[model samples]
Target: MASFHHCIKSGKKGTAANHAAYIARQGKYGQREDLISTGHGNMPAWASDNPALFWKAGDKHERANGAVYREHEIALPAELTHEQRKELVDDLIPAMVGDKPYQYAVHAPRSALEGKTNAHLHVMFSDRMHDGIERSPEQMFSRYNAKHPERGGCRKDSGGKNRLALRDEVIQTRKTCAELQNAALEKAGQTARVDHRTLKEQGIDRTPERHLGPVRIQAMSEDEKASVVEARRDHLHRRAM
Candidate 1:
């Protein structure tokens, strides 16, 4: 099943250029590349052609305490073909990233579990929305000027929201992802579907499975993995009872 995960990174934690390079599997990440398609869009003219230049500028110019980018690490259905998954992602980009300069890549890696594929997409985007005004790299990350918009930095979408509003935004994005995935599955004539809701919300009584991330799963011994599988089977049996 597909899963939704989102996070925002500040300049103090990491630079936007490094994150971009990681997603695109450039530089140091080249050895581990599982890239399918990578691209950038909705950027200022100066950095439109090359996303690296745009992100590098962001790293150099943004304030130390400021958020550099927001990332949505979304799992895609392995049942769908690569092209089908790409189509679904294409539809999603406009909705999630509208008018924001963003970079993204799709990757298909072998799953930790046997006979499965782990296909996913990562989108790294600026919270600042693109306006018509043209600003140099230095001015792009500066404080926004309300009265004279052109002289200021781009307007940010991540700020000014209360905790409740931010929570709602995350829930909405999950719902959107679920909807798109279900539609794609239907189009592909696959019966499998994904849910955005919690188990309680869906009236499921079983204990939710813990997420053992890819690295953890890969590190486990075969015996340990078998034990995990057996445990999950027992859990499911109990749920059925």
Candidate 2:
């Protein structure tokens, strides 16, 4: 079934390096490195080809308590081909990220639920917009200098957004992701469609199912996994009615 799942997360300093390695399927996450397709854009000159270097620098140089990255985890429809999925993400990058430095990867792993293909995209980016400035790695993450722009760090666009604005941005991100997925499905002549609305918003009475993270699913015993599958089956049966 087509699914509409999109979530955003922010990480404090020192997280970007670990996350970049994980998304790139490096280190402990290297088991399925062959199944990963990664790309990066808007990088500064020093780390143009190697985004890991930029992330490592952020971990080392970004201010304490500063958010180093914002990540978007989006589930892609399994009906789309690998190329089609990449194209969908390609379209999203320019719209959402603009001049921000970003790294993204697409992974297709066997679904824990039904052993079918489960494809998804992970995009990690700095909210700091890339200005055409030349600064050392240390200065790049330093406090913004209002008086001398050349001496300051890049500006974080989301820094001053109020709570309502942040909430609206999240809503828009979810809506955009759903629209893109639906468009891709339609282009492929697929009948299955996904909605971004919650069950209550869609006038459905059933409670929404909780999402099990990959790490959590990996840790479950066979019996626990079976219980989850049974619960999912029950949930689907109820949703069908």
Candidate 3:
């Protein structure tokens, strides 16, 4: 099954360029040597901004000057080829970010040692937009607009009546991803399909397994490995009972 992960990070003064460089894999911090390809969008001004200048742009209160960026790491089904995976990601990007500037990288899994290879996409996007005449952060993340309280801003919901939340968007994105993957699988005449719903929601009684990090598992001693295996077996046995 495919997995989903999303995260957001705030960029303080002097860090916007660094974050951009890291995502674009341009500067010394470009550590994703395993990437197959990298792509970017809507960041011409950010790309050219010097560190000092970028820092100055956010010279208001430290809080006001900081920018928030989002990162999403999505697991690509092994059933899809590299090109197909890239195409899927490309289609999803615009839908997610709209007019905001963003960067992404596609990574192929390292040679599998103990399990199936994992391919994934890493996406990073800024929270600001340029409307030809002006550039500003999305209203969803901005301070409350008292004049247009009904429109809300970042902190309040549309109409400023409630708190703005991203739960709905996150859930919808997961479902959309699952639908996209299922469509591809159907086109390929594959039997596998991904589900965005939780096991309980799908009426499945089995307990989900904990994710043991690959590096930690690989470094376990013989006794430690046996203990871990036994724990899993015991859990399954108890569940059966």
Q: Compute each candidate's TM-score over C-alphas.
A: 0.87, 0.88, 0.66
- Candidate 2 — which residues are off by over 4 angstroms? 213-241
Q: Per-prediction RMSD in angstroms?
A: 3.0, 2.8, 6.3
User: What is the TM-score of candidate 3?
Assistant: 0.66
Predicted candidate 3 versus true structure: per-residue lDDT over 1-241, tens digit per residue: 3333333345654455556566556658567566678777765354433332322343332245455455666677777877777777877787667766667777775632334566777776655444343323233334544566435333311122333346666677778777877787677666666677776886757777567786777787777767866764565345334
Instruction: Tell me the spans in candidate 3 whose CA falls farther than 4 Å from its real position.
Output: 1-32, 44-67, 111-116, 136-165, 221-241
| Residue-wise C-alpha lDDT for candidate 1, range 63-172, written one tens digit per residue | 77777788777788867887899898997777777778899998877768543667788888888887788899889988888899898898888767899998898888
Reference-based TM-score, model 1? 0.87
| Sort order, TM-score high to low | 2, 1, 3
Model 2, TM vs. native: 0.88
lDDT values for all models: 0.79, 0.83, 0.58
Candidate 1 whole-model C-alpha lDDT, 0 to 1: 0.79
Q: Where is the poorest 10-residue window by lDDT in model 3?
A: 155-164
Alpha carbon lDDT at 210, candidate 2? 77
Scored against the true structure, residue 123 in model 2 reaches a CA lDDT of 88
